[model samples]
Every structure is written in structure tokens, then in C-alpha cells.
Target chain A: MENHLKNLRAEKGWSQSDLAEQLDVSRQTVNSLERGKYDPSLPLAFKIARVFALPIEEIFVEEAEDKK
Target chain B: MSERIKSAGKRYRLEFGAAMTFYMVVLFGAKFLADGVEPGAWLTTLAIAPVVPIVFACIAFFRYYGSLDERERRLMSDAAALSLVIGIFTALTLGFLKSFGVFHFEWDMLWFGPFLIALWGIVRCALLLKR
Candidate 1:
């Protein structure tokens, strides 16, 4: 799954470590999420959405949905 | 202040200490404590002492597994599963070879625990490298 997590974090001026600290996860997890190598669980998705004050769907996009 | 003390790594460090205590005692006990043992009762007791710490290790590992995050737990589960699978096959082949007169060695239960630990460590490293 592709996500706007990197862009969102960028807009907030947060590095991967900064985002990981905010989310209480490892920086490696944040890096993987940014590179689309790992998908966050629903609860983690909600946390990320809450951190950015955005809807979950607005942050994550399925490949087909993104292309459309 | 690092919060890694609460991590699975710290949990396993304690577990490793427990395991090593059992391992060293059993592995070397028969050599050093070979004297002053009388008859079958004490011999049997000495032979079974290793099992006590092994049980503690199993409980420690169970707690460690339960405490891991999803990704780390998945990786650990995969490593353990692969370790068991590979350990079984290795034992089977070696046992068969020994039975067939192709190999001659006194392979006993004493070696089994250490073998599994070695294999599990190797499998975990291999899995991590693949990732």
C-alpha cells in the first residue's frame, strides 16, 4: 500500500525518527512505512491519521485507487 | 535515558542467562562432580538437574514471545518455526545415518538442547539477512 506518510510528515517538518517517536514505534518501522515496505495495522493507521489530523483514506491509497 | 530495557532484547538476555546456567552445569557437572556420588539415587538426581533450568527457559521464552510487537513477533515466530523444521530434519537424517553404520558417535539428549539453540540462532540470522 502506498501512503502519503512521507509527505505528511514532511509538511509537519518531522523526520522519520520524529514521526516514530510521536507514534511510539521504532524508526525502522516508520522508514518501512514511508518506503511502502510495510503496512501499518488499523490501530496504527488511526494513530497516524490522528497525528496528522487527516482521514485514514486520505493518507493511504490502494494502487488502483491511487491510479484512478 | 533509553527505554530498551523493557524490550524483548532485555527479556531474552535474562532468558539467555538462565539457559547458560543450565547448559554449563549439565555440560560440565559430570566431569567435575564425578566424585563423591553414592549409588543410583544421587546419580539419578544429578542426571535430572538440567531439566529444572530448561523449564525456566521455556517459560521465559513464552513471556518474551508474548511481549513482542507484531513485526518482531512475526519474525521470531518464523525463525522458531524454521528452526524446529530444520532441527527435525537434521536429527532425522543424522539418526538414520548413524543407524545405517555410515556414522558412529554417541549422540545423546545432552546434545539436543544445544543443537536446537545453535540452529535457532543461525535460522534467525538467516531470516534477518533475507529481510
Candidate 2:
């Protein structure tokens, strides 16, 4: 899944560590998510979306390959 | 904060230190006391040393249950699996060497082998967590 997490976090002036701290996860997890190397679980995705006050759909986009 | 990670790392270090100290004390103490004694005496202590750490680690794991989230658990499981595979291969190779008289059998190998295996496994797991 592609996400606007990096963009949203940037707009809020929050670093990866800051977002990780707020999400109660390791900074590496946040980094991996931003880099698209790892996909967050549903609950974690919800948490991220909630943090940015955006809907999950707006924050995460499912690619055509992901559908297959 | 970073403090929490530091604290967890410190606690892990302390636990590992204590385990190693206990392992060495039991191992050396048995060897010292068993001077000219039967082989069973030293063997018993050697067998007990590795088990001690596993029990302590289990206790620590249960005590800190909620602290580890899903991602941490997955990393740990993967690491443990990798460690088991490596350990089995090492055991088989060592066994083959011993049977062929290529390597002499020693009591220390039993303790050191598992210790290194577990240490390497945990380190690998921690690295995977970062990815």
C-alpha cells in the first residue's frame, strides 16, 4: 500500500521519531513504513490515519498489484 | 522517548550478564570441585547451566508481555526459528566431526555452542526489527 504518511508528517513538522513515539512504535518501524518497505497492520494504519485526522483511504492507497 | 529503548536495552544487558556469570560460576565451580571426580559430576553442572538462562529468559518474557507489540513478537519468532535452524546444523556438523575423530569432545562445547547460537539469534532478530 502506498501512503501519504511522509507528506502528512512533513506538513505537521513531525519527524519519523516523533510519529513513532506518538504511535508507540520504534522509529525504525516508522521509517520502514515511510519508505514503503513495510506495511502497517490495520490497527496501526488506523492509528496513523487518526494521528493525521485523515481518513484511511486518503492516507493509504491500494495499488493495482495489491488488488491482485 | 529514546530513554525507554535505552532502559530496555540496559535491562536486557543486565539479564544477559547475570546469566553468563551464573553459567561461568557453575561451570568452573563444578570443574574445580570435581577434581579427580567422576565425569557425571561435571556433566551435571554443564547440563544445568544452559537451562538456567532459558528459564530466566522465559520469566523475563512473561513479565514484559504487554511491552512487546505484534511486530516485536513476529521479529522474535523469526529470530528464534533462524537460531533453531543454525543450531541444528551446527549440532549435526559437530556430531559428524566428533564421530570421525576429527574434533575432540569437550564439556565446554555444550555450553558455548548454545550460548553463541542464542546470542546470534537475538542480534539477528533485533536487526530484522529495524528493517
RMSD in Å for all candidates: 3.4, 4.3
Q: For candidate 2, write residues B18-125 as lDDT tens digits.
A: 776776776677667666666685667755655676677656655443455556656666676777777778778988998999988774665765576666677676
Model 1 chain B scores worst on lDDT over the 10 consecutive residues at B1-10
DockQ of 2: 0.38
If chain B of candidate 1 is superposed on the true chain B, what is its TM-score? Answer: 0.75
Candidate 1 chain A, run of 10 with poorest lDDT = A20-29
TM-score of 2: 0.70
* Model 2: how far residue B80 lies from native, Å: 2.8
**Model 1, span B15-131: residue lDDT tens:** 868786876787578645657777687777776776777787788888867755555566678988999999899899999999999979896987887888888889888876665
Give a tens-digit lDDT track for model 1, residues A6-64. Answer: 89999999888778767766676787788787788899899999999999999999889
TM-score of chain B of 2: 0.55
Point out where model 1 deviates above 4 Å. A63-68, B1-8, B11-15, B18-39
Docking class of 1: acceptable
